[model samples]
Target: MTSLTLVVFSLLAGLLLWQFYRLTVACRRANRVDWGRGWMNLLDGLNRLFCYRYHRLNVLGMRLPKQGPAIVVANHVSGLDPMLLLASARRPLRFIIAREEYQRYGLNWLFRAIGCIPVDREKKPEQALREALRCLRNGEVVALFPHGKIHLDSDPPRRIKAGAIRLSQITGAPIVPHHISGVRGEGGVISGVLLRSHARIKSTSPIYPEEWGREQLQALVQAVLDNKSEDLESIAN
Candidate 1:
């Protein structure tokens, strides 16, 4: 090989190595970001910019308690639901995502940067739940989709999970019921990039899980979602 060719290859290798090191450092810093620090504040600003500009997302009645930890339970419409909710929320949300998604090859760094907690659905989901509960107890906002999967159309108001409610009951954290509409896409990252889908998310006042039984809580969440969906539909029509 010519001496100049070797020099060019060495420069390219150095650049790649530098980029990898930066990614590694970012992942570690994301994991250790202090809860009450400004790091999350910066991220929240960036999130809002992305959602508002790219998806034309709108938020409504999104007031969470100013004092303590709260859990946001929303119906999943598409993969973009989390980003929509995160951007709309007043504070940074620590999302409880599936372990499989967290370990994705190229996007793992992004997930870690957002401080997402991964749940292993195949083996032990309880461990993930416990970690989420711990974060709640420490007064950090946690967000999750109780529908478990994307609920297209009206299939969501009926299908719900009790995990968010259970966590609220244990931690005495209020459950903020959020109903989202207009986030339908072909699904996945590439789909979001190619298809432009706007989002409309609405939130109800916090519901205290400790005050209600499991069934009652579930019914309340269902009612809130049904009502919110109706309002959004009427507006859209």
Candidate 2:
């Protein structure tokens, strides 16, 4: 590995290993799962160590509702997006992850400790929907990359999957669109997806965050894409 990767790798492994052991012990006193805020606190420190800038964007003048199980729809740019969001997440979040990353070495164990839901891509998507909704029902932030896969050609007007819409409809949870723009890097090859750039997370349009019905949710996503004007497509092209 390169020097930077080595440094980051060693740091992460050391922190994760240390934190994992400590949390395992601490969690023994708790119930089945350890959903304590302690993990969040540790993650926040990790963010600082990694120089993660946690900025809340209010482009559309959006304010997150003080509640639970909200759908955090974010643009997929890098593997680091989850870490950044989780570390900077104001409240505890339960992530919806693809089978591969969810099953990756170290990540799976870590995700479990931090409360992430692993999904089988080959399985029926309805199952993923259920898991996401269930997390929501439990009053946890459910994160999803509406763009599905990473933006190989994430030009403006990003093309997002319909899953976020589907979940919002089912749970009546407001779909919070959090846009992540890549700054530097040759896609995922160089380093961080969010290597360096301005990041914006906005949840405008609703206060109590009413869930959009099936038809409405689809239209809402379409409108977002429409307004974005396929910006990623153009840039990537």
Report the number of the highest-lDDT candidate: 1
Runs of candidate 1 with Cα error greater than 4 angstroms are 1-43, 59-61, 156-158, 184-189, 226-237
User: Against the hidden reference, what TM-scores do the models get?
Assistant: 0.74, 0.66
Candidate 2 residue pairs in backbone clash: 154-232, 155-231, 155-232, 155-233, 156-230, 156-231, 156-232, 156-233, 157-230, 157-231
Candidate 2's residue-wise lDDT over 1-237, tens digit each? 799999999999999999988755544432222246666455545553343443322223223467766777666665656655654455666777777877888657787777777778787657777777788888767777777666633455555678777677666777766555533442472365445544444333431225334655555554453345464234324
Candidate 2 wrong stretches, greater than 4 Å: 1-40, 48-62, 152-158, 193-213, 222-237
Tell me model 2's lDDT, rounded to 2 decimals.
0.58
Candidate 1 CA-lDDT value: 0.74
Give the lowest summed-lDDT range of ten residues in model 2.
54-63
Worst 10 residues of 1 by lDDT: 26-35
